[model samples]
Target: MECTCDYILKTQPDWEEHYENCKVKWIAREKRDYPKNNDGTLRLRNKHLLKLDYDVLYHLGLDTKTHDLQAMFGDVKFVCMGGTKYRMKETAKHMANILDIQCDFKNIVKQGHRYALYKVGPVLCLSHGMGVPSMTIALEEILKLLHYAKAKDPIILRLGTSGGIGVTPGAVVISSSALNDTLEMCYKLAILGEEKKFPCNFDKRLNQELLSVADSEDFETHLGVTLCANDFYRGEARTDGAFCDYTEADKQTYLQKLLQLGVKNMEMEATAFAHFTSAAGVRAADVCVTLLDRLLGDQVTPEKEVLTEWQKRPAKIVGNYILKYYNK
Candidate 1:
């Protein structure tokens, strides 16, 4: 099953014509390359990609051969993603100030018109939109972009807002692990009409490092499991949805059980987010600030000013970590 073309191509000058039609497989299916660059950066496992002359990162409006990914993002160390364009832009600005970068920041992904990407010194702060589906689209392209860029051991963080369990509003949560709404500690993914499960988790030492950074900051940080719900309402046991059969008492009971199980917050993307980055051999973490406490209520009833300030907590903690990394 191995390729016969290697010797032919090396030994013959006229092998180009037969190379395209060469029946020999050049890559081994059982043994994969270490999945890391010599400098310890991430590498993708898809073998067909080796033959492609070029790779188009359509969503990011960049490509392998067309754009100089290594030059543009070679220094990138942190890839921070969130739920909205404004938040990521704000994060870019904040990160820039932290890294002492002085310049006009533009959306690097504006051409794609799907996601907002801003390069803040060594940080790639971008918006992943809402839920797993949107995040997945952005994640794939960005991972490929980084792979091409040859960024070393990129720390991918999903910084966003979530609903807390027993914690108060404005509290920040560092996800120790991700769980589905059904309380499964796995990301249920559908592949070719078949459903499969992958362990839903994040980097443990990174979580501790973030927590260590949080201790130096003035924010309430809790480390616990995050319930990645599928919907904004029914999937999260919210009674205020357009349609809901569950009563308020039932919702409260379920939330209490989640609280007892050490779930500190509820979000929509961590399950698959952790899986994607972990599978790519990258260290990742999810840090979110609570908009409201689900144990107390359902709706995010905080004032806009308060919620806006609360939204920035995760960034503040993550920023400190970035600074620590830089200083170290």
Candidate 2:
């Protein structure tokens, strides 16, 4: 069967070779007959050797019987946020309940790979948790859904938690630009390296709205560079010398360098979202609540209570901004 993965693998020499080498290992896993579902049904299975076309899978959502992706969100506006399941689920539920809209969680591809789509008014709130890979997948899926639904004048918002880079803990950082450190690595790894530079641009109007809301709420919001790191724990250092595994001096030096680059916060997904949305000419912005002051050697864990409180301030600011902007 023709699949998007196949096309990508065949066209990219390095990827083709990598896939060829990995094919045997994939074959050892249990094979499930795909196309097993009727022409329109969406099936979920974990088979390694299935030839699934991403484009085909994406389009399947348009076929209502096959996948109810559209039905998932009615006429409500959509917003996207990021966090662990606990944090996201609770926050999404709160938003949905408050907004009086239906919100549902869908698994994007793997464990810890999930997104909550909440619709209220003319906005749709979509959020996910995981690192860069999951964020990329969610963005792709969201784009496909928006395209299939013929959604126009749609504005995408990213609400999530991040570590304070040069800023103080508890200070909210609204990303004006996401500096993609991983894109350079990915391009360099390519056999035929492309000279394309990912443009760092965001929706100007949306940014203004965020700033206005922040100002009105008297919240400290910084508009600067945000680094999207692939390895969160490894990339971020901890003051506690625990899971992050970085020495205090090392962490300070790294933070200083990042701050020199104008990075105010560090997170896992915004870079890719910014890159993709900018390329697609979509309106997108990310508002991240600072959970830890990495520059000051504060450790951030996925503690429920801490995250709950951390999310409330940013969510309130972003949520109010969205309501005011869209409502006006």
What TM-scores do the predictions have?
0.89, 0.68
Index of the highest-TM-score prediction = 1
Model 1 TM-score on a 0 to 1 scale: 0.89
lDDT for residue 11 in candidate 2, whole number 0-100: 29
- Tell me the tens digit of each residue's lDDT in model 2 across 102-135: 7453433333224454444455545555777666
Q: What do the candidate models score in CA lDDT, each in turn?
A: 0.83, 0.57
Expressed as tens digits, the lDDT of each residue in 86-140 for candidate 1 is 9999999999898899747799989998999999889998999999999999998
